[model samples]
Structure formats: C-alpha cells, structure tokens
Target: MKLNIAFFGSSLVSSYWNGAATYYRGIIRALAERGHTVTFYEPDAFDRQKHRDMEDPSWARVRVYQPTEEAALAQLKEAAKADIVVKASGVGVLDEWLEQAVLEYCGDSTTIFWDVDAPATLARVKENANDPFRELIPEYDMVLTYGGGNPVIDEYTKLGAQYCQPIYNALDPSTHHPVEPDSRFSSALLGFLGNRLPDREARVKEFFFKPAQQLHDKQFLLGGSGWEDVAQTIPNLDYAGHIYTRDHNAFNCSPLAVLNINRDSMAATGFSPPTRVFEAAGAAACLIMDYWQGVEQFLEPDTEVLVARNGDEVTAHLQNLSVERAKSIGQAARARVLAEHTYSHRAEQFEQIMKAERTSRAYV
Candidate 1:
C-alpha cells in the first residue's frame, strides 16, 4: 500500500541548527523510493528558514508554516488525514505543545511520537513529574526514537507506551562513502564533529579537551557550531566551526581517527549512538568512541571500533595507533554498516511496523 506519511519536524531543508535533518531525509527518501508519499511540516522558527542549506527535496514535500495555534491546528488537521502522522522531538521550539496537540488532534490516523533525542526527553520527563508528555505517551500508537536501544524501549514501556522502538541512526553509503582525504584536515590525528550544547559541554571538555591537552604533539580538529566564544589555548587543537553536512566525507577522511563523544545524558542512559558514528564508519574512518552500554551490539569494540573510557585511553589510542590496524578496523566497520545499518534497512523495518500495526488494528 502507498502510505501517506506526514512529518512535523525541525527542518527538512536546513541542517543549520537542526541535527535531525539527516535522519529525516534518509528515512523519508527511502520511504518515498518505496512508493510512500511524504509531507514534511517544519515551523519557520530558529532562523532555520534563513539558513536553509538544501533545496526542497524531490522525495518529500517541504512546507514551512508560522508557529501559531491556528496554523498548528490546520497542519494537524491536514496531517491527521494521512496514514501516519509523526510529531518528532526538537521541532526547534514548542515541542511540548506540538506533542500534546498531535495526540489530541490525530483522529483515526496512526499517531507516532518520534523522539530524536530520547535520552534528553526521558530525562526531562523524569525530572518533571507533572510533565504533560508523561500522560500523552500512551496515547500515541507508537513511539520511535533515533537511538537509545533497550533502555529507551524499557523506559517508554514503563511510562505506558504500547510499543516503543528505536530507529537507530544508520549510514547512507551513497552520501557518506569514503572520499579522498582533504589536505587541509588530513594531517590532523583526531577529528570530532559536535555542536557545543550545555548538557554535553562537560563531557566534551573531559573527552576532547583533556585528551588534546594530554597529547599536545598530535593535531586535533574540532568541527561544529557554537564554539567561537570558546577560548582555544590548546596548541594542537584546531576549531573548524560549523561544518556543513556535505563536507562530512572530507572531514572523516582527513583525520587519522574520528572520535565519538556521547552527551552526558546519552552516555548515562547507555544505548544511544548519534548519527556521527554511522557517518564516520560509512566513510571508512577508524572510530574511537567513549564507552557506552550497548556499544558492542552495534560495533565490536577493539575490532570494528575502539572504545575509550577517559583521556588516558584516548591518548593511548592516538599514541599506539597502527596505520594497518586502523585501516583494517575502518574497513570492517564499513562492511558491517553497509550490511546491517542503512536507510533502506530502516525503511524496510518501518514498513513492517506499519503493516503489523494495521494487522493488529484489523483484529480489533
């Protein structure tokens, strides 16, 4: 069946300040390729409209709307006519309002709460007992997350969700495969791509900054937004602010090894792997990631990817890095991602979930 999937998300055309753009594009495009119709509704807030890096995608219809009660209701009404109406987390602003409105307005359509930042959302709900979303969780037909494996599933189920599944970030080999390393970044021993968020600042300091301090002789390149105000006195660490998604391949290929640092909440929850992991691996970049509970389930540690607990471990990897071994690990990770983790794989899973939902509803 050709399903109509309406998505209320951050921004489909802009990755400027939105982290979910890549995930949204990959899955939606795959679904479209499979003959599904997708309509993405993004609020014209956060200056995202001004900094759109991409044109309206051919696979999905992108609609920008004003953030008003009337506008939201209109969008909700239109979306409710579709087979699936998804309200994704971090819609830039008014997330709580959107979540509640979707649950209330989605009439016969299958309502889905797609939590891109599952750890942060769970933490917020836990801290606020009276959070409106707590009661709304069970109302949605299904709860989907970008990452946070079993922990997220268990927590959502405990909170009264009938079904909670993680649509973990996966590699789109077409967009992220290996490219020739750019000379500008190839000399750097370590590369990290992350935006500076308050929740993640301390961990970044501990993992990226401290390690750079320990290994002053090695070059480290940090690429992302919101770091211009940060003082970079560390001699070996270079700040390449605000890397575009198109430049990811060059960034991944340039560094000898790429580092993946999970935010404090994500690390504490233990199953969340951000999009960077798959992107780096897809580009055949050797990945050294911080220790997380479910790291083994995704990539084998010390083989497909390296796990680091602290600055000492990170420094050790940098110092003892063998070119042949790193290359072998990168190749292995690429093979694993291409085989099991890709947008097409995710799209198939989503189709199964929808079919199963329809089957269950038919019996009822």
Candidate 2:
C-alpha cells in the first residue's frame, strides 16, 4: 500500500548529537522511493535546529515543532491521522507520555513504537519493574527494533509485546557511497567515528584505546564528540571533532581501515550493527569490527569484514592489513551490503511486515 507515514523521531535534518539520524534518513528516503509519503516530525531541542546537516528533504516533509508538551501533543494528534503513526524511542521530550498517549490518539492508524536503540531501551525498562513503557508494549499495533535478532524479539515478547521484529541497519549507497578521499580525514592505518558514551567506554578502552596504544607507531584517527582528551593522551591517535554527515564518506574512504565498535549493551546483545558499519561498508572501506553474535548474518567474517575478539586481535588485523588486502576486503564488504543489505532491501522487508499487519487487521 502507498501509505502515509507519520514519523516522530529525533532531529532528521541535524545529525549533531543524534546517532539515529543516518538510519532515519536512509529508511525514510527508501520508503518515499517506494511511493510512501512521510511527514517527519522532530522537536527543536539540543540546538539541533541550529546545526542542521541539510534543509528539509524533497522525499520527506520535515516538520519542526517546539519542545513543549502542548507542541508535541499537537503533532501527535496530526500524526494519529496518518495511515501509520510511529512513536520512536528517544524523542528527547515527554518520551514516556508519547509512548502511551500515541496509542490513545490512534483510531484506524497502525501505531508503531520504533526503537532506534533497542538494547538500551530494553535495558532501561528491564531495570525498572515499574517502567510505564513495559506495560504499554502490547498496546501498540506492533514493535520494531534497531536490530537485535531473536534475542531482542524474545525479550519484548516476554514483556507482553504482541509482535516484534528487527530492522537491521543497512547501507544507503546513494547517500553514503565512495567519495574522493579528503586530505582532512586521511588515516593510514585505522580510524573510528562514534561519539563516546559511558556504557561503551570500558569496551572502547579495551577494543579501541588499547589497540591504539599497542600500535603506537601506526597513525590512527578518531572522530566524534567527547573523546578529545582520550585521543590526545594516545600519541598515535588524532581526534577529528564532530565530523558532519557530509564528511562521512571521506572519513570512511580516507582511512586505510575503519573500525566499528558497538555500545556495550549492543555488543552484549549482538545482532546489532550500528549505522557506521554500513556507511563504512557503503564507501567500500575495509571494516574491522568487534565480534558480535550475528556478524555472519550481515557480512562474512574474515572475508567481508574482519571480526576481532580483543585489542590484540584488532592490532594484529591493522598490522597485517596491506593496501591490497584492505582494498580486497573493502570491495567484498561493499558488494555484500549492496546486494543483501541496502535501505531499498530494508524498505521492502518493512513493507512486507506492514502488509501482513494491515491484512491481519482487516480481518480483525
């Protein structure tokens, strides 16, 4: 069906501090390409309005609202009028109220709780027995996650969710393909682009920092917010502060090899590849990622992507990665995502699920 999709998410135009920006862009663009009309509703918060990556896109109508309960609720009323109303996790204001209130406002619309960070969201609700979102899971028409495979699905089902599925992060070749390597982002050996987070700090210390420390002779690059001091301490590593989305392709392509490190919760849960993985792969960057359970599901380990168990293994991969070897692996990774893991492929899967849900609802 050519549905009207009302998406309530964190900043669509600004990628500043919002990690979900890339995923949201790719998926929404693909959905629009498939004839679905999307009206993206984002709030003016965290100075996201001040640092937009792009203007309102042609594919999706972007609606920027004030960050107030009155403003959010007004948008919710409009969203409930659409064919599919999605209240994504982490809208940054009145999140709990939106989770439950979205359901109350729905009539014929298919209400979806789309979680961009399923592992973190799950962890939060699980820790609190009295979390309001826990009891409200079953109230949504369905639940969609930011890739957790069976583990996340089982957890949500246990908490009384009616239907659950993972929408794994995928490549958007059109948006994030290989670009001319920029001198600004050049890294001969390894580069990583992710904002530092508390839960993932210990793991980064193990997977990223220790490896840089071990390979002190090799030049390394780090991009993202909040790692300036850590990067400076490591003599070999240079910090590229807050790389914009526009520079991401160059960031991926310039580095001989780029790394993908999941947040601790995501890594522990597995099956969750962050958007950076696909973005790097889309640019045909040789990717060495920390070992996760479902690595085999997306890319073939060792061949397509080098999976490292620890800093020692990561150091080994970087040391052993010859120009020819990196290029070969990069090509393989690129081909894999393009063939089996593009946003077009994701949009089709999402369409199928919606098809089933709408069909089932008709009979009900």
Candidate 3:
C-alpha cells in the first residue's frame, strides 16, 4: 500500500552541521522506491539553508520553512493530512513547541516521535519529572529511535510509550562504498570525523586525544566543526575543519584504521551505534571502536571490527596494525553491512513495523 509520510527533521538537503541528513536521505529514498510519498519539512536554522548540499532529491519533496509559531502551526496542519507524520528529535530549535504542535494537529495520522538521539532525550526526561515529553510519550501512536536498543525500548515503555522500536542506523552501499583512497588522508595512521558536542568531548579526549598523543610517531587526522577552538598540543594530530558529506568515502578509505567513539550518554546507554560505524564499514575501512554493551549485535568484536576500552587498548590496536589483517577486517565488515545493515534492510523493517502497528490498531 502506498503511504504519505510527512517528516519534521533537522535537514534532508544540508549536511552542513546536520548529523542526520545521510540517514534521512537513505531511509526516505528507500521509502520512495517502495512506492511511498515522502515530504521532508526542515527548519531554516544553523546556516542550514545557506549551505544546502542537496537542493532537490528525486526521492522526496523537501520543504524548508521558518520557525515562526504561525509557520509551524500551518506546517503542522498540512502535515496532519499524511498517513504518517514523524516528529524527529534534534530539530536544532523549538523542539518542545514542535512536539506539542505535532501531537495536537496530526488528527488521524499515525504520529511517530522518532528520536535520533534517544539516549540524550531519555536522559533529559529522567532528570525532569515534569518534562512535557513525558506526558506526550503515551499520546503518540508509536516511538521510533535510531539507536538505544532494548534499554531504550524498556525505558520508553515504562514511561507509557504505546509502542517503541529501534530503527538502527544502516549503510547505503551506493552512497558509501570502497573508493580509491585520497592521497591527502591516506597517509594518516588514524582518522575520526565528528562535530565536537559537549556530551562527547570527554570521550573524544579519553579515546581520541590521549591515544593520538601516545602515538605521536604516527599521524592522526581529525575532521569536523568546533575543533578550531580545541588546543592542538598533539603535534601529529591534523585537524581538517568541517568535512562535507561528499568526502566521507575518501575520509573513511584514506585512514589505515578509523576511530569510533560514542557520546558519554550513549556509552552509558550501551546499545547505541553511531552512524560513523556504518559509514566506515561501508568504505571497507578497518574500524577500531570504543567498546560498548551491544557491540556484538551489530558487528563481531576483534574480527569484523576491533574494540577498545581505553587508551591502552587503542594504542595496542595502532601498534599491532598490519596491512593484510586490516584489509581482512575491513572486507569482513563491508560484507556484513551489505548483507544485514543497509538502508534497503532498514526500509523493509520499517514497512513491517508499520504493517504490524496497523494490524494491532485494527484489532483494537
């Protein structure tokens, strides 16, 4: 059955500073391919409008709007007509108002609160008993998260979510595949790409900075925003400011082994896998990720991807890096992602979830 889905998200066209653009593009494109109509509504904020990398994606109708109360209400009214109206997390601003407006206006549509940062959202609600989202949780038809696995599911359920499911981040093989390593990044012993957020800075310090300092003999490349303010005492660590999404393939393939470090909240939450994991895997880059609770569920440790708990472990991986072994691990990870963790797979799972929800609602 064809469905009309209206999504309120961070961005679909601009990866400028938006982390979820790749995810939105991959999933929405797959949904459109499956005969669904998708309308993505993004707020013009954080210079996203100025730095739009993709103006017109054939898969979805991209609507950029101002965040005025009047505009929001009007958008909410229009979005209410869809079969599914998704209110995604981290819209950059006015999250509370948007959540309330979506729930209030999405008349007969299946309202879904899709939390891309489930751990942070849950942590906020846990800290404040009177948080509006706490009351809004039960009202939504379903709650979907990009990560947070069973722990997130249980917490949402306890907080009176009618239904909760994790739609984990997946690779888009077409967009992110093994590419010829760029000479610029290929010389680096290790590389990491992420915006410096407060929640993740300490972990970056622990897992990334300290390790880079210890491995001063080897070159380390860091890319993303906010590092300009960071003190670059480590002589070997190169800061490539603000990398574009288009460069992800080169960024992944260039490094001998890419690093994956979770935000502190996500690390504590255990099952959350960042998008970088899949992106690196898709590029067939050897990955050495900081250990988390459900690392085994997504990729096998020590074989498909190497796991590290501390600076010592990360240093050991760097110290023991062999070209043949790294290639083997990268290839295995690529194969695993292609088979089980692609956007096509995620789109199918989303279809199944929607079908099951519809069936359950019919019975009710």
lDDT at residue 100 of model 2 (Cα atoms): 80
Error of 3 at 150 (Å): 1.2
lDDT of 1 by residue, 264-363 (tens): 8889988887888999999999999999898887899988999999878988998889888889889999999999989999999999999999999999
Model 2 pairs in collision = none
In model 3, state the lDDT of residue 156: 98
For residue 227, what is the lDDT in candidate 1? 78
What's the residue-level lDDT of 255 in candidate 2? 82
- Candidate 2 residues 1-364, lDDT tens each? 8999999999789999899999999999999999999999999998999989999999999999998889988988888779999999998977887888888887569999999999899999999999999999988889999799999999999988889999889988988998877898775578888888898788888888898898888888888999977887888888889999999999999988999898888999999999999999999999999998989999999889999999899999988889899999989999999999999999999999999998898798
What TM-score does each of the candidates earn? 0.97, 0.98, 0.98
Question: What is the lDDT, from 0 to 100, of the residue 349 in candidate 2?
Answer: 96
State candidate 3's TM-score.
0.98
* lDDT, residue 33, model 3: 89
